[model samples]
Target: MKLHEKPLIRYATSKTPVDKEGHLYKKGERNTSYQKRWFILKGNLLFYYDKRSDREPLGVIVLEGCSVQLCESNENYAFDIRYEGPGIRTYKLAAEDQRTQEAWVKALLWANFSRLRMLVQDLERTYEQVRVDSGPRHRLTVLGIESEQVTTHLGRPVHGRAATHRPAPSTFTSEPLENFVELHERYRKEVDAVRQEWLSKRNQQHGDPPVADLVDLN
Candidate 1:
């Protein structure tokens, strides 16, 4: 049995945010000829249209669990969207140029939720650690708190430019020194642990010969 595109039709204008939208030549499954189509990539979905002004997609491809790869074909800048499962046909597409091909391939790979979710998780963890390490005062300074007020006060007309207004004494209680001590200790431990792990792996890969491997006949 041969695959057909009739079953792939999901006729509706997608309201999802589009990651990439461009024209690409798609290889016809039946005709084996390349056809110019307007391609729109939303999250985990690749929708194509016969015309760019078309209100609905001609077909929608669920990109989940599928792999996009550059392939050698008669067409230039050809790539394949392959899935190792039944009933789903591999989509072959080609871009106008090498730059467009690379861009489309990268966009398609990043179109999946799994890839975006991992990226979001990594960013969250990294920013969360930065938040934890920074003090409240430091965070407030970063947010420009009290900066405008200070600037306004300083910019006011004074007796002389050399005799600017002196800032009032700070009434806020200083953060505990113990907190800094604890923070330093925690960071030191984490760094030491990471260094040790790296050294262990390095030694396993390129350490000196073992005692058992060394022998003296003398």
Candidate 2:
């Protein structure tokens, strides 16, 4: 659907991340003629302008449930951005070359909010798992020999509770663990902040009310 919504335009600016921007020949629905327009893609919204200098966009396409694919056409590097909903027009576009066409298609496909959210969640899970795995207990558990036997530099076996208390391995230093924890905490804080910022920006773009409260990261 084509919309020149103010909220969308405002959201497009205001320090939003630009995923891609370029010139493309767009096939007009009524005229059936290709016109080159400047397009800027920010998150899921694709905004187009008659010229690159225009402050206001001609229209914006919300690519939430849209799909981009190559289309058979006389024009080289032609593709279509299609939405399944009623009243939504399929956008026909052509890039300069095959490489550019593929890049744009890839960017549009991954621009869907659902896909981006899933990617963010997956990264968070991976980071958390790494942090857990870096802990002393987990490292010891993985090194089964550490639990079964404790030995000295001289290769003598230890016995009882005293035997179990072997010095920490040189590989596992407190300094490195402390550094990892600090970096992990910083990364978590940054991710949480960016996630909240995205939520706010999304709400603004959709004209929805601001979220009542941020999710607890603890």
Candidate 3:
């Protein structure tokens, strides 16, 4: 199946929620600065609403090219999601408690990773679509996937914002083995960094000892 032809399997949800929580922000005068909302993580999009069955979503946050960082303590379980994509945005949100906040962060990271892996798989699938091949090896690759480019460093979108991004133009190249090898090394380091971060967080959640310093990624 083509990239867009595949089913949308992005799913994220916060297990804990505060009743009728409102995202604190300002509007015009004579209007209440806050509105009641239900924040939810579903698929690759983090959206919220007055209710689950509501026809229109208050906002949608794309998981691609996004990153999430848990915030310091606040009255609301405050945290931030930063998006580095074309429609760049940083979202500030708070939940009822720490559990809810942690859940949100984990869900966001998982969804973002899923999106990144999908892109990688799509690139591998595109190997058959290549019109050019690299030197004698006859290799075709763009992501051949050097790791830095595939990080799940997603961005955040505001609750009241609409999706305003267009697909980026393709930049595939049929580079030689040396280029691919260099890319592999670079991406390998980046992937290791991300893997370490994930492992640290995962260990903390599992109440387990730290992983060994040396890892055989192969």
Best TM-score among the predictions, by candidate number: 2
Better of 2 and 3 by TM-score: 2
- lDDT tens digits, residue span 115-208, model 2: 3344434545644454443343322211123312312111222111111112221111122222333434554564455555656667878998
- Candidate 1 stretches with Cα past 4 Å from truth are 1-14, 113-218
What is the C-alpha local distance difference test score of each model? 0.56, 0.60, 0.45
Model 3, 117-211: lDDT tens per residue?
A: 56554443333233122123333323453323433222222121111112122111122211434544544454455556666767888988988
Model 2 clash pairs are none
Worst lDDT window (10 residues) for model 2? 157-166
Which parts of model 3 are misplaced by more than 4 Å? 1-36, 85-87, 128-218
The best candidate in terms of lDDT: 2
- Write candidate 1's Cα lDDT for 1-218 as tens digits: 12145543432363556788999999988889999999988777788888999876777777765666666777887777877778878898888887787677667755543433443334334433544443232221211323223223223221211111121211111122113234334434443444444445556789844323121211
TM-score of candidate 3 relative to the true fold: 0.44
On the 0 to 100 scale, the lDDT of residue 208 in model 3 is 87
| Candidate 1 root-mean-square deviation in Å | 21.8
